[model samples]
Every structure is written in structure tokens, then in C-alpha cells.
Target chain A: MIEIIDLTKQYGKFTALDCLNLTIDKGTVFGFVGQNGAGKSTTFSILATLLSPSSGTAYINGFNIRSEPKAVRSQIGYMPDFFGVYDQLKTVEYLDFYGASYGISQSERNKLIPQLLELVNLTDKQDSYVDILSRGMKQRLCLARSLIHDPEVLILDEPASGLDPRARVEMREILKELKNMGKTILISSHILPELAEMCDTIGIIDQGRLVAQGSVSEIQQRLKGEKLIVVKLQHGLDEAVRFFEDQPMVSGLVKREDGHSLQFIYSGDAEDQVQLLKMALLQNLAIVSFSEIETNLEDVFMEITKGVELT
Target chain B: MRNLLLNPVLNKEFKLRFRSFKSFLGLGLYLLALSVLMVGFIFLESQGSPMGRFRPEQSRTMFILMSFIQMGLILFITPGLTAGVISGEREKQTLNILLTTNQSSASIIFGKLISSVSFLLLMIFASMPIYSIVFLYGGISPGQVLVVLGYYIFTILVFGSIGIFFSTLVRKTIIAMITTYGVTLFLTAGTAFLFAVSMSVSQMGNSSNNPFALFFVMLNPVMILFSFLEPDAFSELSNQLGLGSEFPLWAANMVTYVLIMVLLIFISVKKLRPNMKVKSRR
Candidate 1:
């Protein structure tokens, strides 16, 4: 439900967002992956109507960000990377205040507050002062505040940053639940694996430009050339090594630190792999285990951003 | 107008301000200072009089003294209350989220100015019993007391708008506070000094009416209060300046201040909008 068309933002001579174009469909969780100062926050701020793009424009739910900012704001919820809570406000009061800011009625906020607190697992702490909450809890409260208006889209800038591992998992689960509830989320995080697991589509941004955008598997397939395979033999390790060495598909082979295993880079299809296994069995090598090493999101990201410099 | 006044920013500000211990402490300190001044004035009046019988004219002077003190307190407290309204939000990193909401920049500015003015009004109202002390000896009427309170309200509007204007212009709260105080001091004291200098210059020259001198002093709230307490003096000055007008001096002063306050608030609202400068550049 979000579309950014040739969006460029320049602060004097330094460009913050450089001719970047992206789109996220309705009810999809789009993970924005980038390192520090990679224009993720700038893009989010532009979409949220908190910053004007130097050139081009964006739209959310069919409303232009620059021209119809109020409508855009009404359709989107934005949570900044760092924010402060009012000292004397309670959790419910904090949400109530934002609800009113979005022009949500009192009755609707009263009904929505408890549901939001429960969604963020902060229902028990709803009566506590916002300043007294832990950082992770405060982050969750911020998420709830963003949802107070029940916007169709959520623009979260590093929602899981600075959280403990467990809190990160909780946040991940909450985002997953939000996805199930059909909210289109554009979440930016440097953590690659989490985004891989949570996102339907992932876009990598570098130096204000989107370097890569696709599904995780699609990116992996695009970057994958030679697949790494490991073979573990109970006895007949020499026979397995010789078999792999003789195979034309096996380009390079190395013995594992364990005395009984052989690892090799194989450029082969599934049929070739099956034939190699059949040949191993025919050679009477006691194969314990054989598996292909999967390429992860981190590897894909590193391969894509290898020579990139900070802008 | 109703929607503009009853905004989320105002609602939250009122709640946070009144609920904090600082509000109570500020009120207590304010009353204590006023009480000390009232008692000191009573002591001086008793000592100056023959039989401990304070005259009604002395009570009138005391009323005027208390009004000026209240005005001074307003001048001092209002800037401190409003100088951080926008810059504080920026420091807290909440302005982005606030701007992303449905609340307009005008609403936020109005809400902030009104809330700060409302707190100052509360302090002024709480000090009403101090006015009763002056009322025990009858010289100042209730209407006069109300007029003084109305002037205090006008002063709050002017000073509070100045604070908000500076707050939006500057990104740092400390700098905003300092600039607000500097501007306020210039308006209250420096303007009167310039008026005095202009009057002396006019006296030395051809003795013609100096509209600059009259306008400068009229901009000063202290001079406005003097004109309110003594209309004949303002009229005589106006007649001497060959600017005899249908409107009273206080009315003219209020109009001028109201215009200035509106300008400050308009600038503040514009500045508080995110990327407004960037948008304007396009």
C-alpha cells in the first residue's frame, strides 16, 4: 500500500535519499535492510510526511505524501528509532493522548487501548508510569501508540534495536502477528536473519539507493553459483574423497577438520547430485550423512554490499 | 475555534503540567514571594503612617504595587514555561511522531501557547486573595482588579508567544530559553529606555511630537499598565503628541500587543512544521 517514485532528498550537497524507488503491497511485511546511515530512516521519514523529499514524491493508500499528508498520516502509523515518553503519563494515558492526536474518539480509544496493550504484551503494565518501564517495554508501548489509530500501514524504524535477544524475539512475534492481521509493515533493521525469517519481501539499501529488492530465496538464487556440499563417511573416507575428486561437477574439495568428512564446492543440478550419491553407494562407501550447505541472508547481503562505501 | 482550543497537545500539556510536583512547587514559591512582598509593603506603610492606620490612598498604591509585582512574576514565569515547548519535543525526539499524527502545526502551536498561558492564569487566580488584602481598605474597585488581571493575561499571551517563537527558531532548549528572556527584557525595559531617550531628544529639539517615542513606550507592558492605572497621564501625553484619538491608550496598547502576539504565533506555527523551510525553498 506504499509506493515511492524516484524519491530523492538532499541536505545541501549531501544526499540522504538518492533517486530511490520502492513499493510494498497491501498486507505484506517488507523488511528494509541497511547498515547505519543507509537512508532507511530518511525514506521512512519521507513516507511518514515528517520530511519533504527534495525531488519526486511518495504515496500511501492512494494519498500523496507531500500533497495529502493528512490523509497519508491517517493511513499510516510511524514509530521513530528513538523517542521519549512523557514523564508523568501512564501507559494508557500515553496511548490515549496519541489516539486523540489522530482524532480518534474517546470511546474508540478506551476500547482499543486494552486490545493494543494485550497485543504488545503490556496489558499488565498499562497502569504503570511510562517512564518507569524498561526500554524494551517502552519500545513495545511505542508500537502500541503507533497502532492506536489502527492505521493500515506501519513504518517502524529499527523497532527491535537495543532490545535483548528475548525481547527481539517477542517483537518479531508481534510483527508476525501484525502481518497476520493484514497490516502492511515496512520495518528497517540491520539484523539480516530476523528480517529473512519475518519478511515476505526484503529490500537492501546502501548509500541512499536500493541495491537489491526481492524475496529472500529469489536473492539467494540470483547470488548462488557454486553450492557447498559436505559428505560424512563412517569408514571409507578415502574412497569418498576420491569419488568426489573424480566427479566433473566437483570443482574443489577439502577435508574437514573431522577426519571422516569431505567438503566440496559442487556446480550441479538435483539430478547430478542424485547421481553422485548413487555412485557413492555403488562404490560401497559407508556414507553417514550428505547435505548441501544453504546460503543465508547474511551471505547474500555481504555479497551484494561487498564494495559499497558509506555515502 | 473550539476545536483549535481543545487539542491533544493542550490536553496532554495540562495533564502533565498540573500532575507534576513542579507545578505545586512553582505555585507555592509564587505565593510565598507575593506574600513576602505584601507583608513588606504593609510593614513599610505602617511604619510610614502615624497611628498604624493605613489610608485608602496608601491601599491604592499597595494595589498598584501588587499588580506590578504580579505582572513581573508573569513576565518571568511565562517564558520559562513556553520556551521549551517545541525544542523540548525535538530533544525528546517526539516531534517526528507528533507531526506524523493528524494534528496540524497550527493546532500544536495554539495548544502549547494556551496551555502555558492557562498555567500562568492559574497562578494569577490563586493570588486573588492577595488582592483581597488590598480590598480590605477600599480604594481599588473589583473592576480595576479585573482590568489588571486582564492586562496580566495579555502579558502572558505576548511573552508566551515570544517563548514559543524562539523555541521553534532554535533547536536547543537552553538557547531558546536564553533568547526568550533576552527578547522579553528588551520589550519590557529596553523599549521604555528608548522611549525616555526619544522624549529627551524631543525636549532638546523643536519640542515636536515624537511618534517613535510614543510608540516605543506603548509597546512596553509596564508603560501600558501605567497608562491603564492613570489614563489622564496617557491622554495628556497623547494630546501633547498631537495624536488625540478616539481609542484609549490601553486599547491601543492591547491592539498592538495582540497584533504582535499573532505574528509571533504565526511564525512559530510555520517553523514548527517539519521540512517547512525545505518545502518553501521548492
Candidate 2:
């Protein structure tokens, strides 16, 4: 678990993190969402014990980051956003070096290297030179290096930043596996959908301030104020649209390009929704499908930060 | 102490340094330059003395020349090797990862210093055959050779520590390298120039004895090595300069260098610590 309290970081006159506070529970994946220069990396660096907070404290697994940095460092695995691999070093050597840096013995590293490489799907390239690997491979290797000590918390800053779509999916799968293994993860990325799918909770930071924090649906519901419903018609599309347009519960409606489906924002309770469906059936409207259209994290983010400008 | 010596950064530095062709080429060029000097010294000696006869005095001069050249090489190459040790990591963006590990800043600093000094020692040891050529004529003793080796080690520590200190202070490797060389140059040539001025000032004041002049000479590593090689010349100069014979000159020089090296390493470790500025502010 990670806890940050009133963490503020100021660089001369400019504030990088402004009284930011967040908590990540054990075995939960907390996605940190923000645009560029949004204090996400600053927060990650502070938690990793690589940067000092100007006037705040952070704790990882009950160890304070500023006072007990070594303990905090031992408990967390940090993968930086833009890290470089040592040239002329083999993949296994790279992992072993970091393992030794964490005070892991040779025997331990030897046993752990293969397992970690396999976890990142880089076992075949264990003997290859690190410089010869592609960017995606290097990123995976860095991930494996971070996990060399089997840390309880993972602080990954843009783990899939520059990766291709396939590589990003692979990284996401590995992260999900890490979550299943009971590791607490605090990840920051610009990709909202991936975070929405991967994180138990998402915290949106803007201009060094945490503007929003909640589950995907909670944020969506809080910002949009209505549930979206889609009704697919086999033959009664005009009737369905007319009926919803005249209903008091229907706030907005838009017909799909397919001409057989209609999407509408329904400001009603569950009982009202069920009653509306029953009424449509009684009217003999040929309804092929009726389902709620879920709003994604991207939509929620845009809605929440509608008037806010990026710093 | 053993754990400090066996740190992971030291091991990785050794592996990466020796694995590259650059290390081999540097060693080869170093030995080739020494070989040229050795052969050239013998050739010039034969031309002056005729009959191609070897002499003990010639052997002594050759030993002194070779030691001087080796020390010069160490002074030149140590900065190139160590000035980039930390800044290069920063440039590669690996310093942050290293800092976030459980390894202490002292461990990383010492590991980098030891690794660079160990490679310099390897090159010095590899040129032992050339030193043995001096022993062939029976002028320098094995004890003398041992003392010279010890002096070489101390000099490497001093220069390598300076390199590391600058590496930690500067952000770019090239800037660190230049600053390291600049400081070293000031320590050597600048001290000599100040010593010369002190000598003339003492003479102008009708007192040819100035311990301060000798102190400035002690700041120069080459002068220290020279004093070790030709003790009679040092003694004669001390007699002229009216220096006290209380402490041995070589011991004083060694202590000065060792003290400076320690201070430089301490500052480097403190600079490399992530929270040092915050701690200082508090």
C-alpha cells in the first residue's frame, strides 16, 4: 500500500506538485491520469525516493519515504518513464546487476533472472546484448529489472508510453498478471482506456492538483448526470425514437447511422427503465436489443476537465 | 570493507569496461608508447656513451623516465575513465534507477572510484616487464619498485577521486571531463608556477629559505614522484631552501594526497545523495 499526504514539490517559483494527496490500497491497481507536466512523474519520483518533496511525506508499506528511504526503496519497484539500459551488458547481466544493487545474492539472482525474464516474455533474449534489443524489449527488460527484488509495490511511470499497440497490450497483460499476484500498482499514463480497463480506481491530476479520483463509472456518472441507453429496432425504429422523444425521462436522443438503432440519455431510475421497456413491448414495437451505453474514461475525463487548461 | 569492495557497481563497471575493444586498444597504445620511450632511451644512451655498453646510471635514468611517463599516463587517462562514471549514468538516464536502489550513495561512489583505479592498476601492472628491464642493469631495488607502485596507486586514487567529484558536480560527461582535467592542471602546473614565484620573492627578500615554496612543490604530484626518484636532488634543494628535516618529504606528500583524495570522495558521496539538498535545507 502507498499513502501520500499533502505532498507539495516546488521548483523555484513554479510548483510541480501542489498539496497532492492520494492513497492506494493493497492489491489494487491505481491508475494516475494526467497530461504532460501534470505532476504525475514528480509524484512517482517522490514515492520512489529519487526526489525530495518540498513540504510533505509519503509512506510505502508503512515506511516513510523521506525518513526511511532505504526501507521504502526496498519495498517498491520503480520503472522510470525514460530509462536507458547499460550497453555491452547481456539481458541476464542487466537483471543481475540490479538484483545485486538491491543486495540480492548471486544464487538468488541466478534463480530469479530466468523467472523474471519469462514473466516479461524476454526469456529467449536473456543472452542477447541489451543495446541490440528493440525499444519495446528494452522497456520489458527494465520492467523485469524493477521486479528483480519481488517488490510489493510497483511505481511505473508511463510503462507503455512509446510502445506500439501490440506491445502496449502485452504490457497491460503483464500488469494485470502483476495485480493478480497481489502487487499494489501506481501507474501513470496518458492512455485513458487502458487505465480504465486495468485500474480499480483512477485519479486525475491537473496542474499539480488531484482534480478527480474514483472508479470509472463513478467519475462518469458524477460528470455526465445521466445514463445512456441504446435501443436497437428490427422494424419500429421511428416508433421507438418518437416514443422516447416525447417521454419525460428522456433528456436527449440521437439515432444511429444504421437507422435501426436509437441512443438516448435517460434521466430515470431502474424501475422507470423497466417500465419503459415494458411499455415499448406493449406498443408492439419490434425491439431487437435494448442496452445501456457505457461512457468510457476518455469521455469522463473530458467532461470533468471541460473548462480546465493544461499547465 | 569487504562488501564495499565487492559491490555490484564495481563488478558491472569492470565487466562493461573490459568487454569493449576500447580497453584493449587503450592498453596496447599505452604499452606501445612506453616501449617506444624505453627503446628510444636505450638508443640515445648508446649514442652518447658509445660501444653499446649498459650502465647502472643509465638504468636509473631509464627507470625514472618510465615511472614519470607512467604517472603522466595515469594523470591523463584517469580523468577520461572516471570523469564520466557518474555523469555518463545521468546522461544515459540510469542514475535515477541506481539511486532508487538499496545501495547507499557511498557504495556507488566508492564502487566507481575502485573500478576506475583497478583498471589503471591493471595497465600499470601489465607494464611490469618494462620496469623489469630497469632491474636488468641493477640500479633500482625491488623495494624501490614496490615504493613506486605504491606511489602510483596513491596518485591514481587522488586523480580518480577528483574525476569522480567533478562527475558528480557536473551534469554532462564532456563538461565533467574538461573540469576534471582543468582542476588537475591547476594542481600541477599552477602549483609549480606559484612555487616559482614564491622562490623569487624569498630571494628578493634576502631570505632564500621559504618552507611555503616547498609546500607548493609538494602540491604537484610530479614533484612528489621526482623527490622519490632522486632523493639527493630533493635534499640538495631543501638545503638551499632551508626546509626542516623533521618529517620525511615522501610521507608528507603521501599524506597530503591521501587527505585530498578522501575529502574529494566525501564530497562526491554527499553530492550524489538524492536528499542531501533537502537535508541541508532543513
Candidate 3:
């Protein structure tokens, strides 16, 4: 659980966060969506008790981050966007060092090291020097180091950046497992579609301002009026396209396949639109699947943050 | 638990500072040079005065003086060791991870300070055999050696803390190191010059002792170190048998120096308190 109230940060005349207010429930994957220099990392850094807010109070699991920072720190784990491993230390030794930093006992640390190594799938590489590991492996090890104290919440600032596809998938799965284990996570990533599939709630930050924050569908619903439908047909898509062109609600259609599927960008919601499908059915278009694909977070991001282009 | 929490920093410094072949090579050559020079000094100066000739009485004085000289070099290196504690971590991008942990800023700063100085202390301690050789000349007492060693310890801690403070405040290792060296230089050499000038100026009129200038001597570790090293050389030049009022009784200077070291450490810690801000969560 986390609560940030009126969180504002500034550097002289430049503001990093603008009276930001946000709450994340336990076990909820809260995606902090923001472009570069969007104050997302600033907000994360403050929550982790690494940066003092200019004016704000952050609470983690009911512990005030400014006052009871140690208590708050004990309850939260932070994985920075970029991290370094102790160059000379082994993977397990590195984890144990952080475990010791969190006040975990040596005996307990010795026991936890193996489990953590296994969790990150670096068991065989426990004795390997951390600097020699690949970027993704290092990232995974950084995540495990944050978990050495078993903190209740994880604030991961762009954990997937620079990771290869397989590594990103593994990182995602690891985070999903952490979420399934009832740990609340605040994740920031450049990959919007991946976040769209994983996050229950999302907050978009642009130029130190929170322009939108809510569920996926709720955000999509808030998009300026228009709807898009993706149709996947088994066969005879040419016939289906000609039949759907007559529909007044369909403002635009892009043929995506030779004789299969295409998307219809409709200007109106036009409920009880089954009449169009019925008309297509009469044409023997052999339509297999047809559904509305509303605007995604990526579309909304482009819409809102494309700033001057949108203007 | 506190020690465990501190060990990583100490461990990193220990492994890196000790495991390197160059460090060991430096230590070996340093010891060899000191031993050869010490033996040569004792052998050649066993008979007449040390200036044009040598006296057994002044032989111990020379050793004590050399001990302080070695401590001066120790003082010089202490800042180099501690100056990188924070800034080097920042350069490597390791400071943020440590800062984000449950540990308080005080602990982080203290741990770093201790780790940085730990190796210097080890190097100084390794030179103890050379210091112990002074006892064989029968002029200096074991207590004097201990008081001198105590002075050196405080000297290193103060210099080391100054370095750590500058390291925390500066973002570059070279800048932090240069700043630390500059501060130590000012404290060690600058304070001595001020005291010498004040002592001379005060003695010109009424032969009155300047408690204020004497007070600065209390604050300067190197000056206390100089007091412990240098015997009453002026009196010795006049062929006095024993006792000169020039060196503020060694025990007193030693105690005063230790107290100053403690106070400076506290100042460093206090200065760090307001700046080490905690991170914010989103």
C-alpha cells in the first residue's frame, strides 16, 4: 500500500513533479506511464526515500516516508532504472552484502542467498562475478538484491529498459509472480502494450504533470469520441469490405489482408450495429470474428503527449 | 547486526585495497626503505650529536621525529583514501542503491568513513615494528610511543572524516580528493603557521603566553604530532641535561588532540545530517 499527497519537487525554476497525488493498493500493478524527463523517476526516487520532496508526504504501508523513513524503507524495495553490481563480488556475495545492509543476519543471509539465486535463475552462476554478467542478468540480479529484505512493495523504475526480448519476458514473468505473491508493484516501462496487458491501474505523467490516471477501459473511454473495430475473417474479406462500406457509422476502412481481415475506424459508437454484420452475413462473406477494438493506452499516450502535434 | 551492516563497505575496501598487487608492493617497498634508513641512522649516529656529530640521547629524538614524519605522510594519504568514498560510488553509480536501502544516511556516511580509513590504519599499524624499534635506544618510553600512536590514530580519523565530508559534498572523486587534501593541508600546516606567528608576536611585548594560539594547537593534530615528535631542541642546543618547557607535556597534548579528533568527527556527522535526504515513492 502507498499514498503520495501533494507531492511536488522542483530544481530552482524547473519543476519535476507538480502537486501529484496518487494511491496504489496492495497487490496492484500500478504502471507509472511517462515519457523521458516526465518526473516518474523523481516520484519513484522520493517514494524510495532517496530524494526529499520539495513539498509532500509519502506513506508506504502506513509508514510516513519523511518521518518514519526507516520503517517505510523496510517495507519497500527499489530497483533503479540503471544499477551497478559490485565488480569484484560474486552474485551470491553481492546479494548477501545487501542482505547484511538490510540488517539480515549472516546465517539468515546464507540461507536466503540460494533461494534468491534460484528465483533469479542464477543458481549455477552464483559464484560468477557480477560485472561479467549480461545486461539483463544484471537487471535480474538488481531486482533480487532489492528483494533481499522481502519488502512489501516494489518501486521498479523502467526495469525492462535495454533488456532483450527473452529477458524482458522473463523479467515480466518474475514481476507477475511477485504480484501474484501479493506484493504491490509500481512499474515504469517504455513498452506500453506490455504494461497494458499487466497493469490493473495506470497513471500517465507528462512534463511533471499527471494528465490521466485510472483503469485501462476508463482511460480509453475518456479518449476523444471515436471507436475502432478489428475484424478477423475466415475467408471472403473482399465481399465483407464492400458490404461494410455502405454503413454510415464507418467513416474509414483500411484493408489489411488480401481476402481476410481489415479494420474499420468508425466515427460513431452506433449501438445495435448488428445490422451491418447481418447485411454482411447475407453476402456470404464467411465472417469468423468481429469486435470493437477501442483506443489503447499507446493511442491515448500519443494523443495526449504528442503535445504540439496534437495542438 | 551493526557490524554486519557495515561489513560490505569495509569488505569492498578491504578486498580492493589489499588484494591488489600494487598495494602490497608499495607496502613492501615502504617497509624496506624505513627499516634500512632506521638501521643506518642508529648505526651512524650512535656516538656524537646528530647535526655534525651524534649523541645516543639525540638518537631517540631523531627516531621520534621520524615517526612524526611518517605520520605526516600518513596524514597526507588519509584524505586520498576517504575522498573517494562517496564520489567514487557516485561515479560507479553504486551510491543510489546504498542510499535507497533501509540504512539511515548517518550509517551510510559513517560506514563509508570507517571503510575508507580502515586500510590506512592497517598500513600505519603495519609500520609499528619500526616504531617499536625506538624503545631499544632507552630514551623514549613505551607510554610515549603509545601516546604518539594515539595521536596518529586521531590524526587519521580527523583527516579521513574531512575527506568523507568533502566526498559527500562533491560529485567528482578528483575534486573531492583535492578539496580534502587542501583542507588537511590548511589544518595541518596553516594552523601551525598561525600559532607560530601568534607565539612570536605575543612573546615580543610582555612574554605573555597566548592561550588563544595555544588553543589552536589543541585543535591541530599535526602540531600535537610535532609536539610528540620534537624534543626541546632549543634547550638541547644549549647543552641542557633534561626538561624543556617548549613541548606542552606530551600526555596533555595527546589528550587534547584526541578530544579534537572526536569533536571534528561530530562536526562532520552533523554537517551530513541535513543533506542526506530520503527518496520519494510514486
Judging by DockQ against the true structure, name the best candidate. Answer: 1
Query: Residue by residue across B120-216, what tens digits does model 3's lDDT show?
Result: 6777788888877766656778887787777677777767777877787788999999988888877778887887787677667554446656655
List per-prediction Cα lDDT, in the order shown.
Answer: 0.87, 0.87, 0.76
Q: How many residue pairs collide in each prediction?
A: 0, 0, 17
Q: Report the C-alpha lDDT of model 1 over B1-282, residue by residue, as the tens digit.
A: 789656999999999989988889988998898889888888898898899877888888888888787788888889899999999999998888898899989999999889878888998999999778988888888888888888888789888999999999999999999999998899888898898888888888867778888788778898788777767787787787656587666777888888988999888887776652255232
Candidate 1: where is the Cα deviation over 4 Å? A226-295, A307-311, B236-247, B275-282
- Native-to-model Cα distance after best TM-score fit, residue A143 in candidate 1, in Å: 0.7
RMSD of every prediction: 7.1, 7.4, 8.2
Q: Write the per-residue lDDT of candidate 2 for residues A1-311, one digit (tens) a residue.
A: 89999999888888889888888899999999988888999999989888888887888999998888889999999999999889999999999999999999989889999999999999999999999998889999999999999999999999999999899989999999999999999999976787989899998887789888888777766745567799999997888888889888785588999989998777788899999999989889899999987777675665445433222
Error of 1 at B51 (Å): 2.6
Over A1-311, each residue of candidate 1 has an lDDT whose tens digit, in order, gives 99989999888888888898888999999999988998999999889887888888888999988778788889998999999988899999999999999999999988999999999999999899999999999999999999998899999999999999999999999999999999999999987787999899998888788888898887777757657799999998887888889998785588999899998877788888999999889999999999998867786676566533222
Model 3 agreement with the true structure over A138-196: per-residue lDDT tens digits: 99999999899998999999999998999999998888888888899999975567787
TM-score of each: 0.86, 0.87, 0.80
The model with the greater lDDT, 2 or 3, is 2
For every prediction, compared with the true complex, DockQ reads 0.35, 0.34, 0.24
